[model samples]
Target: MNGLFDALERAAGPVTFAPGATLLRGFALEDAAALLAAVDAIAAAAPMRHMVTPGGYTMSVATTSCGELGWTSDAQGYRYAACDPDTGLPWPAMPALFDTLARDAAAQAGFPGFQPDACLINRYAPGARLTLHQDRNERDFGAPIVSVSLGLPATFLFGGIKRTDPTLKLRLAHGDVVVWGGPARLRFHGVLPLAHGTHPVTGAYRINLTFRKAR
Candidate 1:
């Protein structure tokens, strides 16, 4: 109990852990609101859509992207592209807040000089979930991943490299940030099915912003 509390306190600012991971809970409620607004603006430009996996399966989560490069998947396999296959247009530019937050969060996590070129925005309604998988589409694994969660809370399943490895379940609420890089960069992770709930701002949905250095 004390150890957990200590970890949380140590994570007060941007916090670094393991080789390729960090967590930042530095943003306030207002910051969260601002980020949500940015997401809305980007979504207005490019609506979220469920993408097809290389295995011919449509992902359960609806996703959109911004920045110089966007992550995508299809029968060809997972990779980053300059344009959205759905619309055949360049992805919306990453919001200034998104870049600022990613850089700040990465620095806090101890990965100084991190500059992400891709930001994947995910929207989840009740029962939506992500299966455990590594984020390997990016060209650089040395850079870490910065993920921010907002709206109704969800359980995050942080697992090891192996698919069968035991996982730690974490309850992540609005404004919570999770960073994983270094040795943990390729670790398996996913979200559990979200329970039905309503948030004052987003109604009955959750939004997650996952920033990466795809270039």
Candidate 2:
């Protein structure tokens, strides 16, 4: 975190909606350029592809990943993989900046010393949406999830542990970051369909970087 980002974080003041969940507005603005560049490079190496759920339905979001592990799904199930199913090689190494940003955001949210080994990158074009789901595939639920948003804006759906619980609709804009853990670690969350808009950085799509300790 630089001087500018530190100021931005201070201004945002860690908006908390749950016991262990927080939203930091414009937390990544200072590093957005470099971060987006790294994202482009990672996607170029691994290539983004729509994965099929265990139910055999294809996902609307196009996703790729980086770090020691990558998240994937197919008819088999949703799980973490060491290699990109497409490239048949290890996912691109996590960028140093990504690690730094995740840890800083986690610390800001009151969970210190976070180390993420997996980063799942999702691309949402117009009409793309993610249904509410828990980040339960990880072996350790102790580690928090650090999510950064870029490109277009999207509505984030944050719900309770139960599937039928009411949800809070939070609008997430470019450069925003959300960290959830502890009691909120298992909370169900997702994104609404992205609206049609061109972003200066990502054009007509929204990009989400989800950092997790999948091992």
Candidate 3:
């Protein structure tokens, strides 16, 4: 266990993107197995599915959630709901491991006392891309957003507050955790189209778990 922690630290540590954003590379390495297990349990309760946007277009990426609230989109709009619209039941509870890791990452990123009530899970396949958008459905932007990347690598686009503002491209790999809050809380961000590849953990797919404080 000590050796594993040492390996993870050697791989990467906290990398600051700005005053309010920090990337903790390899932060989830040790907990990857447990996290995946938790995800499996959540998916079993609430299956992953592609959702349609208000614009009447189906999202390329598949999504699901576990926590008090789950994110969903339809002709009405994108919003968080207390239950899975498809299942008509409350989303699976967020695993303790997921909660702990998110809080730890948030503290390391300079945001303490972070308690997230929603954990959005996104699955991307080859050619799947997320367009620039802000996470505004949450009631409080004061809490930081904790995002963990798993499986295949992806290029993360971090943009300014405005959609048209300049963007920075950063490559993210498995076990990476990004925490952003304060001024960076409402920053526009998105994921580039995934490339065809098979990861040792999740073959031909990339899984992202984003923890948020939503009421």
lDDT of all the models against the reference? 0.84, 0.92, 0.91
Report how far off residue 132 is in candidate 3 (Å).
Answer: 0.3
The clash tally of candidate 2 reads 0
Per-residue CA lDDT of model 1 for 74-143, tens digit only, reads 8999988899888899999998888988888777766789899999999998999999999877889999
> Cα miss at 99, model 2 (Å)?
0.3
Clash count list over all predictions: 9, 0, 0
Residue 130 lDDT (model 3): 98
Error of 3 at 61 (Å): 0.6
Question: What is candidate 1's CA lDDT for residue 141?
Answer: 91
Q: Which pairs in model 1 have colliding backbones?
A: 14-108, 19-182, 20-180, 20-181, 20-182, 21-180, 21-181, 22-179, 54-74
Which scores higher on lDDT, 1 or 3?
Answer: 3
Of models 2 and 3, which has the larger lDDT? 2
Q: Which ranges of candidate 1 are over 4 A from the true structure? A: 1-20, 26-28
Please give the distance, in angstroms, between residue 100's alpha carbon in candidate 2 and its true position after superposition.
0.3
Number of the predicted model whose lDDT against the real structure is largest: 2
Instruction: Flag regions of model 3 displaced more than 4 Å.
Output: 1-11
